[model samples]
Target: MLKKAGIAIGLLSVLTGYLIHHPIPAKVPDPWLFQILTDVLAFSELMGTISERVGINRWWAYPGRLPVPRWMNVPEGMKIEKTVFHGIESVVVTPKGFAERKIPGPAIVVYHGGGWVFGNIDSYLPLLVTAAEHTGFLVMSPEYRLAPEHIFPIPFEDCLDTTLEFMSRAKEFNVDPKRIAIAGDSAGGNLAMAVTVELVKRKIAGTLVQVPAMQALIYPKLQMTNYLLPSYAQNREFIFSKDLIPKFWLSYIGLSSQYSLAQIICENAHIDFSNKQMAEKFALVHEDRVPTRYKQRPYNATPQSIPSDVKKLLDGKTKAYLNKMMLDERIAPLFASNKTLLHLPYTHVLVCEYDPLRDDGIILFERLQSLGKESSLQHLPNSLHAAASIGPFDKNLYHAKQNKILFEKVRDYLNNMH
Candidate 1:
C-alpha cells in the first residue's frame, strides 16, 4: 500500500511540473503551478453542482474540515478554541499569552471564502494562524451559514452577529474593542463589506465600535451589475473562469436550476432600477476612475442591450423582492452613497489584474478616494485573482516571491495601524 501511494503521488507531481513549465498556460502567468492548482479546484464546481442536486453538497464541510485544521501548525502558545458568538459557531485563535496580558490587543474577525457555498474554520486555519502570528492580532473566524441552503443575506447576518458577539465579549479576551478589524478573501470579503456597511448604518456600541479600525477586502466580488469589465474579456480560463461566475451566483441565490432567471441575472440585468438616476450611475464601471491601461479599450452596454425576454424575470414578486435587496446597503454596498462611504473606517482593497472582480475593487477604491475616505489599494497586475488562498504552498520561483510579498504587505498594513 505504501509503495502504491508513493507512485501515485510521484505521478501527480510530475504531471503538475509538465503542465506548469513545458508549454505553459496563458493569462495565468508563469510559476504556472498556482494556475494549475486553481484550474483543478475550479473544476470541482461540477462535482459541487451534482452534489447540490443530490442534497450532499455540504460534503466539503465534513471531509475537507476534518483534515485541514487537524494538520495546521499554529504559533507556539496560541490558544485555539471553538466558541459560540451570538448563536454562530466560531473558531477563536489567540496569540500566545493573550489571556494574561495586562494590555488589550488588537483583534480581527475573519470570514472564510468558498464562493459563498462552502468554507469553514478548518479551511481558513492556516491563513488565520499566519495573520495572528504576523500581526500579533487576536483572530476570530465565524462559521457562517453557506448558500444555496441559507440563501442571500443569511450569511451576511451571521457575520454581523459574530462581529457583535466579539464586541460584546472584547474585554474578556483582553482585546481593545475599538481597535478591531474585519477581513476576508473572495466571498468572505463580500461579507466583510456588507458587515461594515450594516454596522455603519445601524450604529452599534455608541461610536467607534460600529466602525472597525480597518478592513482588508482580498479579491472581493463587489458588483454584479455589469459583465463587460475588461478582465472578463481578457481572462477566460485563469482564476474565476468566465463560465463559472453565473453558476456560483446561481448557487448563492438558490436558483442554480432556473435557467432563464439565471441567464438574465448572470448577464447583469436582474435588478429593477426604481431609482434610475442612481442605478444608471452605478450600472457601469467608471472608466476614468481606474488605472490608465484599463481604459485602453472601451466597453459599452445598456439596459436595452439584454433582450426583453430576460427582463421579464423582473415582472412579478421576484422583482419586488430583489428591488429592495439589490440596493440594500449590505447586499450591494457599492450602491452606498458617498455620504455613507465617507464615514467608513480605513480600508485596504486588493485587486488582481487578471480577475473578473478586478475592476470592481479598483473602481471602489477610486470612489472611496473621491469621497475623501482613508483607503489603500493594492493591484496584483501580473497575477490572477483569488491566488492568495492557494499561493502559500506554491514553490515555483515567481509564485513564491510574489506571494510572500503579498501576505507581508497585508501583515504590515494591519500592524502599522495607529
Candidate 2:
C-alpha cells in the first residue's frame, strides 16, 4: 500500500508541473520561447485566482512575486536610494558620479506597469536600472497603491501627488526641476500621460508647479471606450488573452469581482457607442487613424449588442458609473481635447507590433503629430507586450535583443533632450 501511494503522488506532481509549464500558446510571433515564458505567467495568474478564491493572499501567485534575478541587481555603475513623498515610497536610481556634478541634471519619474494591480516598484527595477545606465539621468519609480483595494483615482492620485512632490524637491535629488520628465509602461504609461495632462492643466491655470518636460509611454492603455481595436482582435491571445484587458481595467476601477462582466466589456457592450459623447471620443480610436500595415486583421466596427441575459447583470448604477469612468479624460487620456493636446510636453511613444495596446500608442502619436506637437514614435515589429519589463531578466536571445533596442531608443531620446 505505501509503495502504491508513493507512485500515485509522484505521478500527480509530474502532471501538475507539466500543466503549469504548458499553458495554451498565445498568438505572438515567437511561438517557441515567448510561449514558454507566457505559459509560466499564465500559471501564476491561475495561482493568483485560486488563492483569491481560497481567501489567501492573492500575491502568493503574483508574477511580480517571482524571485529577482542576479541580472536585475543594481547595475555596477548605478546607485539606488529610497525616499518618501506625499506618504508614498519611491525608488530612485542614479547613474554613477551624479553626486559630484556641479549642476543638477534631467530626471525621469517613472510609473511601473502591472496592469494596475500586479506590479510594484521592485518588480520594475531592471528596467529602471537600464534607463539610468543608458540615459545617464536620475530615474525614480513611485510605489503607487494597487487595485481591488485602492482603485482608479486613488492609484492615479498617488502617482500625480508623488510626481508633484518630487518636482518640488528636485534639488535635493540633484535633478533639474525644469527638465524632469514623466514616463511609464502599460498602465504606468497611462498614468504618466494623465499626470502630464493634469500638470499642464494646472500650469495653464496659474499653478506654481513645474510641468514635465516630456512624456514617454510604452504601449500604454490609453482608452477604455473602445476594445474593438485591430490590435485587440489580432493579438487577443498574444501575451495573454485580450479578454484579460477588461479585467485589469475593471480591477483599476474597483470592480474586480465582477468577472462575468469582463467578456461583456471585451465585446464593447459596457459602452453605449451611440451616446454622442462616447461616439466622439471613441472616434479618436478609429481604425482609419491606424496605419495601413497594422490593419492586416479583420475588424468590424458594428457594435456588438449586449445580450439580454448579460444586460441583466449590469445594474443601472453600475453601468452609469462604468460609462462615466471610461469617458473621463483622466482615466483615458486619449480623449483629452486638442487644446490640452497642444500643451503636451515633448512625447515619445514606443509600441510593440504583436501587442494588443499597439494601436493606442500609435493613435496617440498620430494625434500629437496632427496637432503639430513635438513628438516621436518607435515601433518594435518583432516584439510583444511586457518586453520592457520582462526582457531584462529573461535568458532568451530575442528578449535580450528587444530589450536592448527598447532602452537604446530611450537613451538616445533622453540624451537629445534640450
Candidate 3:
C-alpha cells in the first residue's frame, strides 16, 4: 500500500510539473492559470494527431459532441433556451422582463468560434448569457456545422441562412428588423464579416430587406494570403502560435491532406508578391497598412525556400486551387473591393496586442477608414487571443475582468445603435 501510494503521488507530481513549465509566450496578466489552460488545449490537439494516425479520424470533433449540461447556471437577470432558428440548432438568451418591453427590442446574432472545427453553441453559453444580461438585447448563437466534415461553404451557408431567416421573421422573435447586429470572434468573426458583405451585395441587387445595424469582429483571421504580417512574428508563440493557425485554415477549406502546404504559406511563398495583380488583390492586408506602433518587432519580408517535394506538389492543380480559394472574396472578405466595403454598416473591431491575428483586425479597420466608412477600433494591450470568449469560464480573476470589459464595450456599442 505504501509503494502504490508513492507511485500515484509521483505521477501526479510529474503532470503538475509539465503543466507549470509549459511555454506560453504571451505575458498575460494571469500566467499560472493561462499555462494550465494552454496545456489543456495543446493536449487536445495532440490527441487529435494521435487519433488521426490510428484511423479514428473524427476524434477532434469530440469536444463539439460532448453534452452541455442542462443545469449549467445562467447569468443573473437572464433566461436561456435551446431553440431552432430557421432549421439551424441554436441557443437563445434574453434578459428578464424582456417580454414586457413596450417597444420591439434589438437583437444580435453571434457565431461561436472553434477554428471552424469544434466549437458549438453549448460551449459559448457564458458569453451569450453575459451579453444578454449586459446589453438587454436578445442574443442568438447558432451551432454551425464543423469542418473536416462540412467544409467551408456549408458552415458559412448555415450562418448566412440563419441570419437571413431571422431577419425575415423578426416579428416572431419580437425584434426590430432594422436593429439587429451580427457579431463573432476568431473563425466565427470570419463568418460574420463574410455574411455582412453578402448582405450588402444582396441589398445592392435589390434583394435584401433588412440590413444589419453593425458588425463586431473580435481578432478575426481575415486573409490566408499573407501570414508573414508583423503580428505573426511578434507574437508567434502567443496563445495561438504562428505554426498552428495554418493547420486550422487548411482543415476548414478541405485541404488538410495538403498539410505540407503550411510551410509554403508561412514563408509567404504561396502567393507571388511580385505579380502586381495578385499583390493588388491582397493589397488591404499589406504590412504598410499596419501602424508603426504594431511593428515593434523587425519583420523580414525576404522569402524562405520551400522543400523540393512541396515545390513539386505546388506546381500542379493544388497551386491553382489554392490561389483561387485564397482570393475568393466570399472566403476572404478582406479581398473585397472598396465599392463593396463602402456599403457596409458601422463596424467595431476589437484586437488584442498578443494575438497572432492582431494585424488582420488593424488592417481591416484601416481599410474601412480609407473608404470613409464609420468604424471604431478597441485595442487591449495586456490581453491575449480568446480572452473575450473566455467569458464566465475564466478561472482567474484577471481573465474575468477582461471578459467583462470586452462584453461591456460591445454592449455599449450595440446600445448606441439604438
Candidate 4:
C-alpha cells in the first residue's frame, strides 16, 4: 500500500508539471513555455493570463523585475508622465517632466513592432526609458491600432496622422520640431519608412509642412516580394519560422484561413507581374553580392504564375496599398532615385550578421553611401535577429555583452544627432 501511494504521487507531480508548462499552441509553437521563459527573462510584470503561472516570486526573478522599473519608481533623476495624445496613449519620460521638457529636447516619436499583431508600449518600456535617459531626448511611443481588427492602411494612417498631430503640438510637448526623428523595430520599422515616404509625398503636394529629422530602421522588412532570400531559406526554422511568417502576413491583412497555405508558399497570391519584376530586380543579385558560400545551395529561378482567384482578391482592398512604384525608387531605399536619397537626413543603421534582414540593411547602406548621404552603419557580427530584445534574458554572457554594445551605439548616435 505504501509503495502504491508513492507511485501515484510521483505520477501526479509529473502530470501537473506538464500541464503547467504546456498549454494549447497559440500561433507560435510552444507559446506557453515561450511566454513563461520570456517573462522570466524580461522581468515583465505578467498581467492577464500570463500572471497565473509565473507569478512575481519565482526563482528567476532578479535585481528587479524582467523590465527595470522607471526612474519615478526609483529615487529619481527624471519625472515620467503617462498621458494620451488625441486619444492615442503615450508615456512621456524626461529629466524635468513633461511641463519642463515642453520645448527644448529633441523629440523622437517611437513605434513598437509586433508584426502588427501583438506588442504594447509597456512591453518595450525598458528600452524606451533607457533611450530617453541616454539621449536626453523626449521620446513618445504611441499605442497604434493592430491588425486582424484594424487591417492595413488604417494602422499606417493612424501612425502618420498621430505623428502630424504630435508635430503640430510640439511646443506643448517641449520638443524641437526640426530635430524630431522616427524609429521602430521590425513591423514598426516598416511603418516608420512608410510614414517617411508618405511625408515626402505630402511635402511635395503641399499638405504637410514638416518631416522627420532622421529615420532609424532596425532590421526592417522593407519588401514582401522576396520569400526565397538566403536568410529566409537558412534561418526559416530559427526562432521565427517560415510557417509563422505567412501566418502573420495573413493576420496583418485581416485575411481568414480561406486562402490556401500552398498558394502563399509558392508566392502565388501576393506577387503580381509588377511585384515579380520588382523582386527580380532588387532581390536577385549579381555574383559579387551573392557570397560564394551561399551559391553552393540550389536556388529556383522559375517564377510561379499568380493564381486566378488570388488575382481577383488582389484587385480589391490590397490594390491601393500595392504600389507598382514600390518597384521604382521610393519604397525600397536601396533602389530609390538619387533625388529621393539625397534628401534623407543623417541616418544610423544597425545590421546583425545572422539576421534575415541583414541584406536589406547592407543594400540600403551601400545605396546611401553611393548617394553621399551622411550615414553610419554598425554591423554586429555575433548578433541575431531579435537579439536586442532577447539579450537581457539570455543566460549567456555573450548576449548580455551584445545588448550593451547595441544600447551604447544607439545612445552615442542619439547624443551626436545635432
Candidate 5:
C-alpha cells in the first residue's frame, strides 16, 4: 500500500509539474506559445472525454479562464456606458472627446468571438478599447446571446437589430451614422458579415437607411460545408478546427448531445458528394483557391474523394442537424447571394496563414472584389488565428511584435475608411 501510494503521488507530481511549466502565453515571442495556447483554449477536446460520460448542455468557457495579462487590459480614459441597442443590452466605449465633436464621428460595432458558443461583450474589452482609441471611433459591442441556448437566427438577428438601431441613432452617440463599420473575429466575423447581408436586404426596401461604411473580418469561419480547405490541412493543430469545430457547430444547431455522431457525419459529409453540382461547388475552394506556398504535404492534401467512417453514421436525424447550419446563409455567409454582397461596404479581411479559416477569409475577399465591391485583404503569413487578441496592445511579448503590426494596420485601414 505504501509503495502504491508513492507511485500515485509521483505520477501526480509529474502532471502538476507539466501543467505549471506549460508556459502561459505572453505578449512576447515564444516558440511553443501558439501550440501551448492552442491546448489551453481547446475546451472541446479538453472536455471530450467527460463529454460522453456526462449529460450536460455546456462545459466551461476556454480561453476566458486563461490569464489576460495586465497589458492586454482595456485602456484607461475610455468612458464605458451600458445602454440598450435594439432592445438588447450593449456595452459602448467612447472617447472623452465625444463632447467636443459637432459632426458625428466614425463608429464601429465589434462582435466578440467564441465559436458562437462562448464569449460576451466584456470578453472583448481590449479590442473594443483599442479600436475606439486607435481608430478614434465610438465602439459598441453587443452582448448577443450564445448558441445551444439562444440558437442560430437569434444571435445573427440580434446583431442585425443592433446595427439598424445603432445606425438610426448615431446622433445620440455623436457618431456618423454613415461612417459606421462592423468588426469581428472568428464567429463574431460571421455575425458581422451576416449583418452586412441584412443591411443589403434592408437597402432593397428603400433608400432611407445607409449601410455600413466598412467591414473588418478577422479570420472568420465563412463556410461550414467545406472543411477540407487548404488551411484546414496546413493548420491541423488549430484548436478550433481539430479540437472544437463540429462541437460548436452541433451545439449552435441544438444538437450538443449528438456531437460525437454529428461530428462524424459532418466530417464525412464534406467529403461525401454524389452530385455533379456538389463536386463543382466544393472544387471552388480546392488547390486553385490556395496560395501556392500554403499548398504542402504536411496536411492531408489529397482531394477529399474518399469518404470517412462518418458516412456509416449518417441518418435522417444526422442530416437534419447538418442541414440546420448548411442551409442557412445566416449561419454560413459564404452562401449569401452575390446580389446581396454586391452592395456591401468596403471590406478589410485579415487572414492568418496558420489558421484553418484562412481560406474562408481569402474566399470571401475574392468573392466581394470579384463582384466589383471595394475590398482589401491582408495575409499574416507569420501569425496564427486570433492574433489580434494576443498580447493586447503590447502587454507582453507573447506575440507582441506580430500583434502590434496587425493592430496598427487595422487602425490605418479604419482611419482611411470613408
Candidate 6:
C-alpha cells in the first residue's frame, strides 16, 4: 500500500512538472484564465490610450472605452452641408465653396463603415472632404439604417437606392455621373462590393440604369466563412476581436440575444456538410499568399462538423445570403468572374499592413491583375483598420502623408480615366 501511494505521488509530481513546463491553453475557461484575460485586455486598452495621448497612434476605440482627444476634430477649412436626399438624410462636405470651383468635375459616392451597426455619414466627413479637395471631385456621403432595427438587405438597399438617386440627379449636383466612384471603409466596403455586384447582376438582366465607374474598398469584410484564417488567428486580439466580429454580425442581422449569438459561436445552430464544402471552396486562399512569418504559430484546429439545424439555416434565405458560391463571390469582390471583372472600370484599393483585412485587399489586387483589370493599390504600412474614419486629429504627419499619397493616386486614376 505504501509503494502504491508512492507511485501515485510520483505520477502526480510528473504531471505537475509537465504542466509547469507546458502551460494549458490560454483560452481555458478557468477563473484564473478569465482574470488573466481581463488584465491583459485592460493593459492593452491602457497602452492604446497612452499611444494616442502621445500622438504615436490613431486607433478609433469603441465609445465610452477610450477618450477622444481634442486634436481629432475637423479642420476649419472643411465646409459641411447637411441635407436630406430621397428620405435619407446625409451630410455633404467640400474643401472649397461651390463658387470656388465653378466647373463640374468627378464625383465620389462615399459610405461609412460601422460593422453595419454603428457609424454614419458624419463620422467620416473629414476624410470625405479631404478626398474631394485633393481629387477635385464632388463628394456625396449617404446615411444608411443600422441593423437589428433594419436587418440584412436594408442597409444594402439604402445604399443602392441612394446611389441610383444620386446618379439620377448627378447633373443638378454639378457632377459627372459617368465618372462617379463608389467608396467605403469596413462594413461600408462590404456594401460597396455588394452594390457593385447588384449592379453587375442587374446590368446582365437589363434592370439597373447606371453603375459606378470605379470602386475603392478600404479594409473590407469580404466573407463570413473562414473565420479561422491565419489573419484571424494572428490578430484575434486585435482592435477587432474574432468573437466581437460574430457579435456585430448578429446585431446586424437582428439576432442580438446572447443565446442566439452563443448558438452561432458554439456552432450549435444549423450547419451542414454542403455548407462546409461551399465555405471551403469560397475561402480557399493560396498558401503562398499568406506571409511565411504569420504561419509560424502553432495552430491545431479541427474541421467542425456542421449541425443539421445549422444546415437548415444555411439553406434558408435568412442565412442564404451567406452561401459561398452566390454570396461569396458577391461579398469577396475579388472572387468575381473575369468577365465581370473586365467590365469593371478603374479600381483603387487601400490596404493596411497591420490590419487583419490587409490580405483580403492584397488577394483582391492579385485577382484583378490575373483578370487583366485596371487597378491601383495603395498599401499603408503603419495604419490599422478604420484609421481614416477617426479624421485628421487622430492622424500623425506620416499618416497624413500616406493619406495624401493615396488621395493623389485616386485623383490621378480618375483624371486619366475616360
lDDT of 2 at 44: 77
Q: By lDDT, rank the candidates, best first.
A: 2, 3, 5, 1, 6, 4
- Per-residue lDDT over 185-288 for candidate 2, one digit per residue giving the tens place of the 0 to 100 score: 99999999999988888888898868888888988999997788788877775644445788788888978767657768888878766578988887898778
Q: What tens digits encode model 6's per-residue C-alpha lDDT throughout 94-192?
A: 555543556666777888887786666655666776777667677888888876567776887788888888888877877777778888888888788
Q: What lDDT does each candidate get?
A: 0.69, 0.80, 0.78, 0.58, 0.70, 0.62
Best by lDDT: 2
Q: Rank the models by TM-score, top first.
A: 3, 2, 5, 1, 6, 4
Error of 1 at 181 (Å): 0.7
**What is the Å distance of residue 397 in model 1 from its true position?**
6.9
148-176 per-residue lDDT for model 1 (tens digits) = 77878788889998899788889988988
Model 3 scores worst on lDDT over the 10 consecutive residues at 57-66
Give the Cα error of residue 56 in candidate 3, in Å.
4.4
Q: Which stretches of candidate 2 lie over 4 Å from their true place?
A: 1-33, 51-60, 65-73, 297-308, 394-418
Please write out the lDDT profile of model 5 over residues 273-304, one tens digit for every residue: 65454455556555576656666537774444
Q: List the residue pairs that clash in candidate 3.
A: none
Query: For residue 24, what is the lDDT in candidate 6?
Result: 24
> What is the Å distance of residue 48 in model 4 from its true position?
18
Residue 314 miss distance in model 5 (angstroms): 1.7
Q: In model 4, which regions exceed 4 Å deviation? A: 1-75, 96-103, 262-270, 274-338, 391-418
User: Model 5, 196: alpha-carbon shift in Å?
Assistant: 0.6
Better of 1 and 2 by TM-score: 2
Q: Model 4 lDDT vs. the true structure?
A: 0.58
TM-score of each: 0.81, 0.90, 0.90, 0.70, 0.84, 0.72
Q: Considering TM-score, which of the candidate structures 1 and 4 is the better prediction for this target?
A: 1
